[model samples]
Target chain A: MSMIKTDKLIYEYAKLDDEGNVIGTNRAIDAVDLEVEPGQFVAILGHNGSGKSTLAKQLNAILTPTEGTVWVAGRNTKEPENIWDVRQSAGMVFQNPDNQIIGTVVEEDVGFGPENLGVPTDEIWTRVEESLKKVGMIEYRHHSPNKLSGGQKQRVAIAGVIAMRPQCIVLDEPTAMLDPNGRKEVLRTVEELRKKEKVTVILITHYMEEVVGADRVIVMDKGSIVMEGSPKRIFSRVEELKKYRLDVPQATLLAYELQKKGVKLPDGILSTEELVEALCQLN
Target chain B: MSIKLENINYVYSEGTAYRKQALKDVSIEIPHGQFVGIIGHTGSGKSTLIQHLNGLIKATDGVYYFNGENVYADGYNMKSLRNQVGLVFQYPEHQLFEIDVLSDVCFGPKNQGLSKEECEKRAREALEAVGFPGKFYSQSPFDLSGGQKRRVAIAGVLAMRPKVLVLDEPTAGLDPAGRDEILDQIAKLHKESGMTVILVSHSMEDIAKYVDRIIVMNQGSKLFDGTPKEVFSHYKELENVGLAAPQVTYIMHALKERGFRVDTSVTTIDEAVEEIAKVL
Candidate 1:
């Protein structure tokens, strides 16, 4: 069974007036279909207010679809009885680390998720230790979350999600607020977590560079899936992505520009190594 | 007119065990109407340095002179100084609170004691400079898109008609097109009005493309200050400080490493394309 499956999902919310009257309805997520297999790393890219967050909220039952259906691990998100099972199967991490972290101490924050799930005390400690180690934040387990850097705090946030033992993880712009180094650190941790825990990963981000490593990339525009393919396949059409107000990786842009200048380089050169190799072949 | 800082030191939470030194003996000079980019890792004193420019935060130690006057001196007229130097914080849109976009932009000029008519005229000009449509003047800032909201916030600062504008990651959280739109407007403002532009950003590509000068901050001190070509040449030093040159710089270096005779000093995409075309 697919780890996550959305069948023609449509999410709409009432546009409210100052008097709390529903004046109109804004369709945040239009009819969209998606499927993600277990242990697969998928990336969702879109501009702000493009309904990427709305789609992510659906997977964890944070927001049920207004029409159609969303299923996580064969449990429908709209079913009230299945909400707990759905949430257990998929965990979410948001952009701001400051808002997500609740515990004063690092390890304590990671343990909160499991504790709320009614896990035993000793088991919570074990999961906390394991999750911290997975994200390479074990050394700072006892340290205060307030003192941690943006990257470190984000790592602790990811550890908190992992401690819940979810089958899949959905990160909605987890590194959006971080510096380049912090972003690199968080991406590396997420990659490492996928390798160790074998959890299905769904990352929604605006940074085109981060999407390069994903097994598949899904592009959304106006609440619908406009493109879905491997990173290379998607980034190859630079002009199409640009039309959606998205960017390609730096190397990809250089190669594209070079190609426009009539240099015979291959398409979708995702990294510096590939671009260098293509340029060197010209000689 | 120039802004000068000499031996500036800022200590956070002083007289305590957890006291931290945010800025350490940093000195720099900004000539009038010059565009400068400041790049640094998080907590490397970038914010502290920019805050000093507009007199938002006084240095715990050292002298900061604005246009030959010591701003720290008593009766320095800081209100007028702030009017002269506008500082736009990151995600500036969050500060917008007025009911309508035009009023939001007019808030700064109104606060500066301009007449109602003068405030509206200045706000309209500022909005035009930021490419905000006149049709949206009466619309609530909350009803605008993210990019539009950001531009509206920037217009608020510009409405004050400051000689120097310091933006802290003005393009943060904006889409690629939105980023270009904001930067282009700032560049246009600098070109047409000859206003000083100081952009604090993490994206080296932006710095390389827009700024005439680059200032690198590391560990609470000035690491390097020079033209983009001179500063980015020391890529290894940048990497050591948890920062890096633009991705194209690294790609150029990779080409050189691969025995291709290409200049690694190319920072922007156009320059890199030109150099690579010459080689090909």
Candidate 2:
């Protein structure tokens, strides 16, 4: 069974008038279908207002679909009885670490989720330690979150989610507010979580380079899935991605420009090393 | 006209147990009409340093001069200095709270004791400068897209008619095209109006493409200050401080190592493409 599946999900919110009356509806997510297998790493790319965030909200049941259905861990998100199980199965990490972290101490923040889940005191501590260790933040367990760097705080946010032992994780532009190193740290932690914990990963981001390592990439535009494929395959269509207000990785773009200038380079070069190798072989 | 900071030091929570020096003996001189980029890791004092520019935060120890006038002098008018040196905070969209976009932009100039018509005139000009559509002038700022909201926020600052503009990560949450659009507009603004621009960002690619000079900050001190080509040449040292050159720089360096005669100092893609084509 898929860890997450959305069948023609449609989400619409009421557009209001100046006097607060509902004038009409704006369809934020329009008839989208998506499926994520267990332990798979998926990246969703889109410009702002592209409905990527709305789709992520559906997986965690933050917003029940106006039409169609979303299933998490084989349970329908729209069913009130399954809401707890659905949320438990798919934990969400938002863009701002400062907003998500609420505890004074690092370990306490990580334990918040498990504690709220009604886990025993001893079990909560064990899960906290394990999750922190997994995210490489165990050394800062007792430190105040106020003093931690942006990367450290974000890792602690991830640890908080993992301590709940969700089968999947949905991160909504998690690195948007971070610096370059902080972004790298968060990406590494997510990759490590996918490898060591075998949790399904769905990352929504605007950064093209960050999604290069994703197993699969889904491009969203104007509240619909416009393109979907492996990262290399999707990136090969650089022009199309640009039409949706998205971009390919810098290396991919450089290679494409070189190809346009008649340099006989291969399509969809994803990294600096790959571009360097391709250029060197063009003798 | 120039902005100068000499031996600036900023210590947070001084004399407390959590005392920490955020800026350490840092000195910088930014002349009028120059585009400068400040690159640093989080907690490296980038924010604190900019806060000192508009007198939002006073330095613990330093001398600051704004166009030959001592900003720290007794009876210095900080409000006028702030108007002349506009600071746009990170996620600037959060600062937008007006009922409509135009009025939101007018708030700054209106605060400067301008008449209502003059405020709207300045606001409209600022909005147009940022390339914001005039059709959306009456739309609620809350109804705008993230990138659009960001532009309105910037327009609000620009409405003040500041000579020097300092932006802190203006493209933090924007998409690729959105980022490029904002940066391009800023570049055009710099070229056309000759306003001094101080941009703080994490993307080395953007800094490499836009700024004439780059200032690398680490551990609350200025680590490097030079042209894009000169600063990015120290890519390895930058990496040691949790920063890096643009991806093109790395590609050029790697090609150089592979026996290709490429200029490793090329930081932008256009330069790299031209250099690689020559070598090939």
Writing each residue's lDDT as its tens digit, candidate 2 over B59-152 gives 9999999998999999999999999999999999998998999999999999999999999999999999999999999999999999999999
How far is A201's C-alpha from truth in model 2 (Å)? 0.5
Pull out the clashing pairs in model 1: none
Q: Which docking class does model 2 fall in? A: high
Q: How would you class the docking of model 1? A: medium
Residues A1-283 of candidate 1: C-alpha lDDT, one tens digit per residue: 9999999999998988879899999998999999999999999988877889999999999999999999999999999999888888899999889999999999999999999999999999999999999999999999999988889999999999989999999999898778778888999998987897799999998788899999999999999999999999999999998888899999999999988888888887999889888888888
Give candidate 2 misplaced runs (Cα > 4 Å): none
TM-score of 2: 0.99
Q: Which ten residues in a row have the lowest lDDT in candidate 1 chain A?
A: A175-184
Model 1: per-residue Cα lDDT over B1-280, one tens digit each: 5899999999999999889999999999999999999999888999999999999899999999999999999999899889999999988999999999999999999999989999999999999999999999999999898999999999999999999999999988887878888999999999999999999998888899999999999989999999998999999999888788889999999998988789999999989989988877
Prediction 1 global C-alpha lDDT: 0.93
